[model samples]
Target: MPLTAALLVTVPVFLQAPWVRSAPMAAALFTLPLLALALVLERRGQGQWQQLGVLLVGFCGSWLGGCLFWGWFRLHPVMHLPIEAFALPLAVAGLGGRWRLAGAFYLGSLLGTACTDGVMAAAGLMDLWPQVLNAPLSEAPLLLQGAAIQVLHPWPLALVGLTASLLVFVCRRLWTLGGTWRVTAAALGTTLAVDTLFLAAALVAPHLSGLI
Candidate 1:
């Protein structure tokens, strides 16, 4: 779990670096090593193949979604959030009786995202909240704008932590539902719920303002 967490946290940070960020293929290429590691680790476990399937499905879904929305269609990167969030959990839930594994993937992914954002904010690469909230819903990629990191604020951290916890709780509950359709419904609903909560917090809260 620790190794997995480390990979999850590190992969996003590495991919988001200015040079890699400018090169989409490089970012995708860098993810391969981590994906390989994840596969090796899961193969040693009980649900080895199932877990591997989950990882592959998640990666493909996220990559394809990114290509379609952020690349071909030119949608705002912010709009990709819910799709990226839904893909992994939905794949895990598809495993039917393996809610524990699904929950682990869901939590791990959220932890990774939060850790990446925190690290980027600390390194003065980006302002955490405004980059998310003020993101244009048209064609801009949020992290590539070269905006100076704004003054560190406490509220966004608190809000992010709160939202992460809430998402975990919701996912855990979703895992308890029976049937693939039920799980899918729960996963998609939770995705929208969390995204909405994040957007609302970023927009309505004064202390969380950014250059957007």
Candidate 2:
């Protein structure tokens, strides 16, 4: 379950990120097929496949939210969290039902995104977001690298350390609960890992960071 949840969190980085950039409507529409497959698996599949269906249902929510925001609201960095959280009410309601795993994964991913955005805001990187993203492709990498380097300063580095430590502690606590909480832990932990890698990429190879 943990491995599957982790892959679901990571897959969007490679697949959805670029796809949404060029074809937002197509990316958004793809949710139908994903949800269809998920429903089919939930009805006909057993054991692991059934579990994957539930997770895919959750992924569809996240994927759609991402496509909406990155597609149209990318320039408005401040709207990122709100747009990505469009399914918050539904996810919360699903928590006590059979789709608890889906809720867990979505909530975990949302929490990670919140924390990342909070850290970025605190580190003063939020102000640079539009500039870096809107810059010409050839120039964006340098801007992104500069933004990544800014985090190396003492204050931003301290903020990053504190946030990372807090998230790790939360993940460890969630891990102790077992069951669906483990799904939450894995999703959150994988998101943190991905954010770390993205930062590294922004520093060393910003063009590959997928933000552009």
Candidate 3:
């Protein structure tokens, strides 16, 4: 299924995170252990360690979801949206019934991609001379797309991280319930806005300079 490839792609990307920049081959090997941890966290239940388990699981699941969506669907250029945008956010809303939490998951995945891309870009990974469009050429178009994401609609990496954090935090604090559908509606609305913005920006980005 998509989850497998998502996990596969997530490994190297995390290892190649702009911050680390390990050799491509080595990065894959490095993330093998994390892969196992990801499985454990994903399967973890709501017991004493539930919070921590899901926290780690959310990160991995979101990351894997994005990678799998992008690789499986072949949504290139701007893979941030189509990749993991709808599915995972919807999952958060469905599973936790918390808009803030779901929103956070959406943004956190974007943020993860953003951080990976940003670190690489800063380290000269994106500086490679190759562009499908006319803008600044980068090595991985996915990374470029990650860099291009925004906080409000298009959903930047920081936004994802913040949203996920808020989701986890608020749920724990308030422990509210009975608003599942409302939260679901809000989550869907948020996804729609992000999709609209991404499409609009994509069309306009070609004509503009580095504004994208």
Highest TM-score model number: 2
Between prediction 1 and prediction 2, the one with superior lDDT is: 2
- What would the TM-score be for candidate 2 when compared with the true structure? 0.97
Write down the lDDT that model 3 would get.
0.40
Residue 172 of model 2, lDDT score: 99
Ranking by lDDT: 2, 1, 3
Ranking by TM-score: 2, 1, 3
> Clash totals for all models, in order?
0, 0, 13
Candidate 1's error at 1, in angstroms? 2.0
Error of 3 at 170 (Å): 14
**What C-alpha lDDT does candidate 1 achieve relative to the native structure?**
0.43
| Per-residue lDDT over 14-124 for candidate 2, one digit per residue giving the tens place of the 0 to 100 score | 889889889999999999999999999988999999999998889898999999988899889899999889989989998989888889999999999999999999999
Cα shift from native, residue 183, model 2 (Å): 0.6
* Span of 10 residues, lowest total lDDT, candidate 1: 143-152
User: Poorest 10 consecutive residues of model 2 by lDDT?
Assistant: 203-212
Q: Model 2, residue 26: displacement in angstroms?
A: 0.5
After superposing candidate 2, which stretches have Cα over 4 Å from the reference? 210-212
Tell me the TM-score of each prediction against the true structure.
0.38, 0.97, 0.33
* Candidate 3 lDDT tens digits, 27-56: 334335654664465456454244334334
